[model samples]
Target chain A: MKKAIQYTTLLFTCAFALGACEKSELVDYNQPDMIYVFKDFDSDVKDSASYSFAIKDESLQYDTVFVPVRIMGTAKDFDREVKWAPVDSLTTAVAGTDYEILPAKVPAGAFSANIPVKVLRNTAMKTNEVRLMVEIRQSKDFAPGISDANGSSWYMPGASRRYLVKINDFLTKPNNWDSFLKFFFDTFSQVKYAFIIKVTGRSEFPSGSTGLPYAQFVYYETVCRNALAEYEAANGPLIDEFGNRVTF
Target chain B: MFTSIKYLCGITLAIAMAGCYKDEGNYDYNEINKIAITSDSTDVVVSQQDTLRINVNLSQTMPDASGLTYQWVLYPTGTAQTRRTLSETKNLSAFITEAPGSYVLDYFVTDKKTGVSFQKRFWINVVSAFGEGWMVLEEVNGATDIGLVTKGNKIYRNIYSATNKGAKLPAGANMIQIINYRSDQEIYIFSPNDMIQVNYIDFLKIKRFDEFFFTAPEPKPQGHYLLGGADKILYNNGQVFPVSLMTPPPFFYGLPLIGENPYYMEPYPIYSVLKGKFFYDRISQRFYRAGPYDIELSSCPAYNPALDAFDMNNIGKKMLYAEHNVTDQHIALFKNNNHDSLFIYVLDAGIDNAAIGKYDVTKVPGLLGADHYMMSKTLTYLYYSNGNKVYKLDILAQTSTLLYTFPAGAQVADMKLYLNYDDFEDPDNYRVMGIATNEGDQGKLYYFHIAGTGNFTGNTYREVFSGFGKLSSILFKSRS
Candidate 1:
């Protein structure tokens, strides 16, 4: 009986020791640092964006486009360089003539940085659009993350490795002309648009939910009407490129 | 068996350890001071610029009212809620200067010892001192001013100048329009070269012509009208500018309504929520319609000659006056280019076959020479004034009756029927007529109460107010 009691006491001691043992330190998974191009939450484009200089001022010699790059892993305390290059086969714009890719770097303690690309306005862009395809390359600090494969786990496919930009300077009909702007501007013509730009000194007339106030549109209409009348009075009837009499 | 015994022993040891521990901290409890605030009146009505007083009684459990701090707050109950601190005393004796509307008043009593606050809410109705009256637009000494004739037959002359620091309106001010939306009451004074909007409560200047637009158009206001109770439309330089008052102020006019072609629209607009807005395009000599959401004017569908009374697209006459009568039917008066032929067209406010009837009223006495016209809202009669004689014409019976005549050398300046669309249940609405006449620099305003049969109640004017000026228009100001 004495021996049995001693064994029970020993068993209770062992149970108490086992119950007190637990993990007190956190585990580190040590995920590798990765980087990618940041995508706008509101935009549907995965890896591409289109730009036009048609609405820009004629005197604007050069414009810069900033592409945001994000780090998929933890941010660093020191600044890191981001390696990028243009795909040769898919690129139609010459590096030195049509555009210049500026040096890209992620700032210290930042999750994202914008890569600025300086685009030059050339006479050729008025007749034909040029394309520049940029892709992320592996660097000392980061590896190209989020692939363009079909079954990637990333929410946005092809959003990390590649980004394409289409640039042009040719004039085209505004997307909101028929739905909204027609009430103020009766018809759309290249010559009429140019005249409007000259009179209002503004090329961008946005419409839809995020457009300017209706009062601004009315002011523009009145100004354009008066300008057109004065133009016709000074010089005979203003005509469009299509040989049609331009009227507001 | 030994394994089960070992587990039981371990559990017993854990329970014994927990049961042996005891709390060593000391705690004490005491009751907090309770406060009670009471007021006799929870709903009060007062006029604008009048003093509002409220008495309150407060009691606390621990001490008397000496250790209590009080605060009174007032705020408008409209969509644009603004809070104002009225007083920091126990009793409120505040002079209300807020616009005429509904407001909420809150009284708070805080106990200094316990830091507890007790509150009570009260409802207040603020009516304007210049409420529910006729605003007479008159030209005094070649400059525009306004007078008010209250429902009690009291005349307040030059009220605009009195409230606006003696500043007279523009010289050519010809119209007065009152717009009430949500909790806003605005008075617009329009002139040929300028326009001004004033506050309904004090007649203080709110916005001038240049302030009404992003890029101000020419100051040539033909007329101003309301569309569907929420949108205000202004006509200037043969263009229509509409602004929805539901938007926050300072309100700016939207894009003008321009169709596929250039056209000029008459200032008078026939509007109803169901029918949207209709306008007479003088350039085309036709009628146009625009839906509530439409931003441009659209041509009315072609009328069938056999089934329709008249073609909306082919009305080849100049519009003189157009208005909607009591039954919501539209009546328009027009004349040919020669002015020898006069016509009256009746149309439904909103229907497929809009034309109701068309009649030649060229032979109707006093109509061709009339300078001011008013349509009766309760009957099928048209009242017009020429020289000093007022005449009423019955369209269905094709008869004319002389209503009244002013003194010799008196000329009718303006005429209007008392109609308040917002308050249809008011006793004085749609039951009276106001006429203004000028005689050698003296303007006289007369109010006639109409009977059910479209005749004067006593066969004479109920009230007459005379002063110095040349009255041009009279519009009723409502208290909402």
Candidate 2:
């Protein structure tokens, strides 16, 4: 009777330990540390000349996470020059996996690129999340002659851009794959609005000596409240953030 | 919910089944050909070979055949004649010469399929033309106006008259009278005073200018929009635009027939060009395009009896006449009558009797007192009357010649030189056809012969008719 009781107790203890171990194995130690920032946030324009963005992923100090940033810019003219900063944004983007940007033929001046990164897991903490702030500026064209110490900053005429930062880890529980995936999908799915303004004026020829009468300055402003209105009308409804319904 | 699902599933299944079903609605008999024939006419007489052309229209009413072929057969007037098969039915003209007999043409058609046929028949005729005929001209009973002329088959009312303002004769009226020269087809003549009020609308239709639409010529180089064009009516803020094209509504200038709708007048006026210049009448004021004209608006003062030239001042008194003078800057009336005698001279040195009489140019008391003096003169002969008789004063001889005594029971309507006479030998040898209607119970015609025998020896008179109507002016149809 005494032996039977001791064996039963041992078996109960082993079962409970096994359950705890399984729970621990399921925990996700990887934390997202990717961030994307657009330099021209409020002044961002739609269908304007293209420009560049700066994407940073501080994942080396956090955990193993895919720090993929998508660079998006639009312009009215189909073929307006939009050279990217760090000019080789094209060759750097992953063709199929981490950042699968498409239209197999890369356009002449697309300012989209990716940086492959391997994050180092945090030693002291089991999980940690980091942010990467990227600055995006639009340009009608690029002037390699102009230089700035911080990533060689330059502008194209009539260029506009916006900054968008995405946080990877902002949750109470670490092993939330569903929530993490939802956030990842929601970043691109939200509807974005952009505004564009054009300024024009006429003056005397720079080379002439006589005083010349000049026409009044003209400014044209248009607000693209939601870029998705026309798109939604044409193509039923677009998938929105995390199963949220939106017509765009 | 489950029932709805089942219903949707059932409906989908039914649709699928229906797709498998063959469309048998179109699986009926085929109509290979539809043959129809029409004649220029239906019946005819013998001895005339009417060549009826058979038009064989080839069509395949059946959907099975890609194309069709036609087969024609001639029947009833059987194979006893030569050249019967009309050129092997290749959608070409088949010449079937019909002879002097009653005949029926039978036609047939066929398709590529073995079981398709259509047939039909038509009737024809051949006869001789009709010949010439005669007509009678009768006067309308009470009106005494010229009545009617019957020609061939249609009878046309005689509208001829002596006054120019009266009805104009038909275009072929003179030809009908002269060429036929048949006494049975006599035309009745009406006096000027016997004029009837002709309906203006019917008269316009007779004149062939009743209804017409004017197509404006292509607009000029520029600024033609001011004249006429398609315009968009628009309101400024709220008020409406007030521009309008104003003109009088059209009407006629004649009398109406019995049971005719009197209000069916022409609604638009046509523009007329006179003497190389345009003239437009609003049915009220006469507008001269490049000249002067007298005009009266709709809102004019009271009618004055003696008001001349559209003025309303001078009433119950003798009025002066003033025509627009081109060379002179003043009114130029040669004469005026103040209750009695009128004498007038004009720039045109010719005899227009109506202008002279209406303008009161001659010394004749018009239409009133008969104890009056009347005078008329040409270059050589002078005519003057002093209450008793008319005397022909020879201007060359400076002596008066007693022409003719005014016959009793006669009222002179008009006197003019005999336009029908070919020649004259002396100053007194002139011939005049006088229009006179007897003032007695029955009017009469007196043919007076004024001979130049110096002592009135050739003044023989013939009383033609005692109860004759008014003697209207005699117009020569042909001088030759």
Candidate 3:
């Protein structure tokens, strides 16, 4: 029993010594070298700056469209700088000719900033399509985030680091035109024109002569469209005072 | 002597050595002694789908970061504290699921090296999305629709139509009441010709209640409660045919309904079991006490011996407007007698002339009995309407004071107070009321807040919404 006791005590002493040595030699590594930017873009709705829409010639006055930018893991004390520029060869919309680009920088401790771009109007580009694509470049203060598509975060990052800007006079076709919007738009147009012609007794609608505001466009495209649909469903398809059926 | 001492010391040292093992070297004696859960509130009330953030403040911890295990266990509150792991992080939050009612969240931590553990429990109340709000019943073009107004002033219309298999609530529902019974919430919808009950938790499933629950049959009952109906009284001990008042005391569940043409004016008041389980039966211009006699003391006021019976002939035959609070055992009202008389009947007073008084509402002269009215949740005030004018009546003082009078032609259709009794984190502040009224051709809800006194005058209100139908009855569902 004495021999066994001595052996156990000796083993315990050696184990304790080894544990103390191991803990004393532990090292510290708690620094992060990179940060991330998160975006929450739900494919279901293009309501915000999801894709691209235009100010068009119908808007007599110039308008500015603001794009949102966000970054994660921002330092509390120092401000971070990010560089953005339009790819010259691929860009069709001129800077001073079409739209003006505003200052873009993220303040200290904030995860979000807005990039404002001024869009101009020209009657000649009413029917033709034009786009301005801006690409993001990394800087010393920040980089493209480690997690590009963060499902957990609010803002979803688009493919690569690209933003598309457009300016046009006519209604920019919605993305889901073929699947859902086509039928509603067609029906709404027919009823709308008929109602307009009957009310004003004119060949062309006055609002159409200029252009519809983006907000008015959405309202007429959805809310008013549904209301008119309900009316037509209760009654039959709309026709003019002279017994002429209306079509877009 | 030296030899004997040497042998004893050797045996002692060997025993001590034998007690120590290699396991002691691997185990860390240091561990967390105490732990506390800190948040905006310990007893928290959250709406469905809301996020709850919890931060754990630890008194001590193991030296190695990887040598500890954290767990957040959630379960319903009670003896059956079945464990459900919500998370394993040190300090973070969890998005509340759609489950409603009281819950217990326990933060458990175990030291991997020492096998020592610490745990603490947090009480979290998850209420339905319909928390702290008034459920308005609107009569649109003769059809019944229900609206919800939250304490935050958010309003929803025709919730019954939207929630229930697209089927509308009982059309032209005259009254809406939320009753708490047997560990569940039942919302009763009353129409003049029909009646139905639905579960407030689901807001979709209609309960197949006992046929007797339908108080308003073809003839219309003068009084209703858990035990009595149109002209009958039932016993709590058994489900048998009811008897008359002339029968034995045990059989007399309620007073007999009389009068050739009695109109059951008071809507059935939803109450907790501790308060007035019995209801008031008004027949032949007389009020009779009806319901179970047994109730807890804290809920009921000290019984006043003078309130056995009272003659309400001066007030009127039908109720112009009436609301009863079971917890306080009082029914505040505007008598259908149409004499501008407002009265408060304290059930504690058990005598023939037990009415507190007959107060005149002359201060608000032009006001009518009521177009739509409601009793404040505290049972302290009775809000009634004349046409466009609304007045607040102090039950104790028996005085009616003018609170608001809408535009000359605009008529107030309905009124309700939003009360939050289930929330423990927030102090009781009954500052908001929803009003449905018509100004011209349009009917809409002009929900407003009574800031300083909640007296209706100079209170801020927004014409927040308009609707397709006329407003009928608005009720704030209480979470008991």
Candidate 4:
């Protein structure tokens, strides 16, 4: 009975090992579920033309690398088209300029390799979350049917955060609401607000549960009206979807 | 065990390989620099003139050198001298003055590569002296039209022939220009043959307009001093005789050698004059002008001798008047009783209406602009008109009177008076005739006779010359 049990255990073990070692299309290495490091890059994209990353070296020198970046947020939701490419040769980059990316071999303790991916100007990334899928691979192995056997890695290319560019005391970025409120309050002076009140003549909407002060709400309404007036004075007024003047 | 080990090795190897990639980039380029000029040079020099040499140089800081050209110019000190280009190279040199005086020089330089230009100027004085005098002024004997000047100073017609041809007068000798009324020329001297034996005790002196030839104390070279008028004679006695009558006989005529187209009369009486150094008046303070210069002269009251004298209101501190001789078609000004001053009037029949005028006695000499003033249109003489009616005008009184009526179609377009001293028109003797331009303004000379009371006497007339172009200002020069 012991002999029969031993044989049976060996057979089962063999079956389990076979199942674990299944060669299904070379383990489908491409299906590693690409993790785009630049997924949130376009949230406050300052410049869509250039982006960079670091790499540990004494490694394979790649002629080119593929960085898959997707624009998320409203732009991606609508499937807006965007340009994607690897950074140009490093020799062409200016040293001190912030816009260019400088790549170097791992010097000492930390190994860093920057894989810069750029979006051409005409096809700039819109104001939205950009999901970048970047893979560092040897130029020779970059074929349609073959994947890099010994040279491929994923990385995020940017400051790894979002920021707003201040211009003329006004925030140039945060092309959305969340950061817009921060910029508005930070820049507005007391006298400027008072002047706004005198110019726009408007009160607040009735409060529901928020219990915000009526005067504060009134100020916001006036601010909106004044902003619209200033915009009209500069670039003309806005028209409704029906082609009629849009009154506040 | 072998299968598990192989699979583990494959997965681990893939992970290690994926993290191996390098970037080999080296960036370098050339630097950029630009060039520019910071300052321009002002140097120049003129020839022979003792003025210092002035040169023009450019002050610039440039990076690259390529197409650059320089130029210099010399202009006379006054605005009348148009600026001219002298050079196309950097040889900007000019003499400020041949001697001691002022001159203007301008320099310009241009960069061909960048198309940038620079310019500068300097006023320099050279060490040299001008000639002993500014210019020499002399009389052209026998030339009839000698533009006379005294030590380069333009002597106005203030003195006529007050003495003999070779005679010199005291520095401040008082004199008057004896204008011959007929030929429109001043009589520099009276011919000896034309002199007549008149009553020495009853010498005539011209004191006022109404009173001609008044009795005055005459002595000491009386012949050379008197403002004499000549008349041809007839042999009534054994010797030649002159008609004692105030009006000369047919042979005895008055010379009309003052001016052609009676000063301040004709197409229109337009007058203009310079009141100050730069002030110019073209119109008689009536028309509104939309131009660079808006000069208007206030027309004050006329000079009236009848009221015993002029009221203070009639006299302007800086004043001018347009006395129109409607019958003569000539315009003239009596500048502070200096009637023969260089303050002549010019009509504007061209662009800008610039009065072609020259100042009388200013240090800064140049021609100014002026116009004519039309007072009244009337025939001051009697008889000889298309309508056969003689017209007369009293300007100060502002009255137009008809002296005589004439037949139809004898249109008297122009009534011109002539001073016929020698009466070149008459063969036997001299006769001062009234030249009239009639019917379409055609000119004709007539033997005009008006009574002492401004009445018509000899209306019967004859026509002389024709086809004259409105007879512009005529300057008559006779055989002295």
Candidate 5:
């Protein structure tokens, strides 16, 4: 009888210990399924968030940069996967050789994620000034906040997911790309380490691989159209270099 | 008995060796009837510029067919089916065209009732158009005539009248084309209802057509006769005929090109500007190109975002006139069907956002485009008219300068570029501009020169003539 009373007291103490341990249960943050990322989601699709980086760090090695991705909605119950991939189909970049992208996912229960993309800031990149453009796409688990940001994406406004990045240390750039990034778009974008599997059948910008020529071609088309529209209203329609009416 | 058998065998052998035959009962004789074809000339030689006609006489038995059909098939020498059926009729007359080779003009008659047919072929040799000069077509007094223009500006006008032994030239000649076929040059005159083939050298009428095709056709055999007509593409296995009568006619191929609109004239108007051939339906706004196989066709409106397409409704036929600049590779000048808008075509290089590969000339330093524009042979400068003033524009520089100022109230009727080619083979040649002014009572041709490096800088014109009637078109006949 004495042993049974002592065992009952011990069981009560164990139950109280278990009840005290149950206070830290998993919390449901009720976060939205659609969380946006990227920095400049508000500009036109052709207008991408641009960034530039010197090929070398202070130690004279290749430079590593991180692209910031922020969550748009509330936090989640469990760790959520934010899928990310390089818009590599249009890129001539190689994952290991030219650049790198690591940890293409948002960690569970994290409010923000940083995509580390590093490039071979070598002499070739500085000389060619080759540009790489990428956009963050929505996956099955997560949807974008804004639609048509960076052309047909659901990234939220001001979350410019399309990054037009380059590795250059030029003292004077022809198309003023550095100024354009600083003034027109954001300047804090990293290289997208997507790879180019195909060497042909791509809609290359009119400028080929040159940094500013493609931009200039697009700008010329737009400005010329605006100028021509007025000419047609007063004189008739504008004629092309071929002497035919422009349909635009 | 052995001796008698031997003798009988010997006799049988002898008879077999002598080709002996025996009659079973009575022999019968059958008479097979046949038809004959006769013509005045069986063997003839016609130049590529000459038309061949033969009046054939059919035997009495040949007319016994229920619906006796006739096919004048033109077959080339050395084994070929008929390239085209020049004329099909039951009448005695047969029309044939020769395309640079020895050909067999097959006169075929078939009886639809009995399915019996007869063929009488005549030999015809066609000379090629090598070493031929230009054949200029002139429209005077609202009548059309052909003029033979040899080297050194030697011109013989009214060759159509001369070819017809002094008959007046046709009244409704729309266009003239000197076609290079059979290695020879032949001239074709297009009218509202006829296509007259005239000898390029002799200026003699070769053949006349009552039913010729205009636009993309269901395929007919024209041999090389339709070289500049519509698409200039024939649907054949590339052979001249004895038209295996089993096949269909050759047809018009190729979709309309940039700046080619079908000029709805009864007879199709096809004009050659250098190596380029243009077929336009003036009323329908359908344009066709004779050259450049890569020209976008098939799926048409020929989507061109570079060109400023005329608004057919608001412009209302004001923006459809098209002019070709031989020096410009892929450009065509289009004035609004009749409106004041001027559009340019970069041929197949269609622009983005524009409908048919064209663009409106922007507001430049001076006038850039007009209802009437002329391009230099160098492909650099363009002359456009705004009212009575003609402005010269440097295409590369995108600047316009006044080139010529006509007399007040005198509308510039026509502008032509005359290239004094040092060598006929070279595409680039030094050229001058000829402007025709219509001052109500009379028309005058003025010659001028503009000096610039690939541009016309000054406009100093000399009056060439004042006696001509309303001058319609000007063509420089170069060597073929």
Candidate 6:
């Protein structure tokens, strides 16, 4: 009788202990509202972006560049101003002359917004590139969020608080000149590229998904070839900057 | 300890016994009705715009036919298998609007009660009504229209205007060509400053001048040629634009063929089986060739003076006509810049050792003054027309034979040999020469049977077609 009572007590204890264990739930934290520059999830770079006016038309005097920013909290019913300014110490461009920071706001019920920076085409950009470093500032509605230096393993950060852009008007060989343009334009040379620009009346030759159809490149090839032939016939062989004969 | 272990074992046994206890739940089961579908024919052949009717005989194990829904669907057999619903009735009676090709027809019967569907499949071959014939391009009432001469010699005049809602093509339309590449059977009408692509089967206008290119060039269409159904070359204003039709539609012509040196190619393109495509550069007075898969044009390599009859790099004459003759030999007629001297240069179409022979035909009677020229694909003979007379010049013998003369008032407008690149075994292929004449607005066409020796069989026309308006060109529309 005594052993039966002891076993009954032990069985009850095991049942009670097993029933007390429960799955853990995550609790939301009450934190301050904050914002940061959103980074492309697939990109390895954390804080920089570059643009060249050489790929744009010569007639374009000013162009707007957008930087994406995301909030760390829930969206609100009312719009919120996103505070951002150029870091003077790291910036090589003059604010009023080289670029202008437009007003930016995250609209109501939206978690993200684009900070527009209108970059101007200055004559000095033709020979040298201009750099601008921007950072988020504390505002009335929100505070600066997680940054690369403050990020933890559980919450990795990107260019969350700061970003940089390099702008230039100097001509450089396009990224797709060999894979796509070479079939039509043969080889890339500064002289040939300049001649192509003059004959086609365009400066940009975009590649990748947004690239022009192959047929258009073929037209440029023919036009450039004919123009080069005429130019040579009137003058002599077209000599490039490297003292090489230019041919299509 | 022994007592506690015994009590725990008893509890565990009680729990295991509870898991073995079973409960009876209320449920039901039933068998589904089996359906069987049958048709008289599983293989069908129909033409475009024709009705396709098929009676389906379906039976169910349980007599609940009223609850069954029917659907018929048709889709092409090519890579783009876009299914189109044909009918919802038990019997299919739908008109096929698909292009000429193979297709699949499916009959689906679904039972509402069981939510089950039974299907029957069929294979369909769709043909075009205007599949094969001769298309005659003519200038009627100051505008261009097309006429069709069926294999049975049935004439359908003003077919283009009738099919296109009375919209007429521009005047001075000089060429009508059919490009039957892969699944594309397109007809193009070429005028001086305009060009239009029409449906090969219905002659309905499909595209206009600016639609043929991504960036439309000057509208000076010289000619359009196909290189063995692989590449299409379009010549406009002395520029050559080539596009590969080996892929699917939405094809646009790319830029002209560029070389290390500048060149202006004549309209004639000679495609050799082994040597890709050849073009005569009018500016440099030389020959340039693009390989089978090449986009750029390259000049022919230097040749030996003793072996080669003429230098391909420096012909120094204007190309009047260039086309492929018998076997691999291509015959080109050249005239001096002054238009006084005429010569015939015969060469193999291949790149190496291209020159075979050259002949001075400036002294041949009525040869230099000929307006139209066509080379025999089976023999070494050149057929040309001067005034109302058509002469057959024997290229081997260097002699000219007067074949036939039209009426005194008749003027030869155009001449073409009945050649079908798609159907070489066609009954009239290379055996009949069609000549169009204009005798004071009363246009007439004649078909002369060619003899084995490259002459007219009876020195006369075998068939004569009239009621045409000043024909400019005629081409055989072949069906694949």
- Which candidate should be chosen as best, given TM-score against the real structure? 1
Full-model lDDT for every candidate: 0.80, 0.28, 0.53, 0.30, 0.48, 0.82
Q: Give the DockQ (C-alpha) for candidate 2.
A: 0.01
Better of 4 and 5 by lDDT: 5
Model 2: residue B455 alpha-carbon error in angstroms:
12
Alpha carbon deviation, residue B21, candidate 2 (Å): 92
Each candidate's iRMS in angstroms?
6.0, 31.7, 27.4, 47.7, 46.6, 5.3
Cα lDDT tens digits, model 3, B1-480, are 444545655665576567575564666574353443455556777777778778767666335455668888778877744656778988647888837868888887777766777777788889877755777777666677777766676776777777786777665566676544434565767665445666685467464223533221242322234322212332221111123222122222222222123333244342333322333334444443322222111112333446423343333344444455434345534454666544454443333333444444444444344666676765567777878888776766656677776788888877776565455344434566777777776666766666555475355464466653666666667665
lDDT per residue, candidate 2, B3-113, as tens digits? 554455556557546767987788678444443434343342322222345454444434454444555444334454532444346342544454333454445554556
Rank by TM-score, highest first. Answer: 1, 6, 3, 5, 2, 4
- Tell me the lDDT of model 1 at A14: 61
Ranking by lDDT: 6, 1, 3, 5, 4, 2
Model 5, position A199, has a per-residue lDDT of 15
| Model 3 / residue B110 / CA error / Å | 8.0
Q: After superposition, how far is residue B379 of candidate 4 from its true place, in Å?
A: 14
> Residue B247, candidate 6: how far off, in angstroms?
10
B30-68, model 4: which lDDT tens digit per residue? 543333332233333332333333333344565456757
| Cα RMSD to the true fold for all candidates | 6.5, 35.8, 25.7, 38.1, 30.9, 8.1
lDDT of candidate model 4 versus the reference: 0.30
Q: Candidate 6 chain B — worst ten consecutive residues by lDDT sum?
A: B245-254
Q: How do all models score by TM-score? A: 0.74, 0.22, 0.45, 0.17, 0.34, 0.66
CAPRI-style class, candidate 5: incorrect
In the range B78-164, model 5's lDDT, one tens digit per residue, is: 879657787887543443345566787778887676666789888887653322333344556666665544433344566568658
Assess each model's interface with DockQ, reporting 2 decimals per model: 0.24, 0.01, 0.00, 0.00, 0.00, 0.20
**Per-residue lDDT tens digits of candidate 5, residues A1-248?**
56456555545555564466476879878754665545543322234322334322335545555566667776656665555556766666656655766545567777777655666555565555655555566766566554344434445334555555555543222223343322212122221010000111121222212232322322233333344445567888644444545542
**What range of 10 consecutive residues in model 1 chain B has the weakest lDDT sum?**
B242-251
- TM-score (0 to 1) of chain B for each candidate: 0.78, 0.28, 0.61, 0.22, 0.47, 0.76
Error of 6 at B367 (Å): 5.7
Best by DockQ: 1
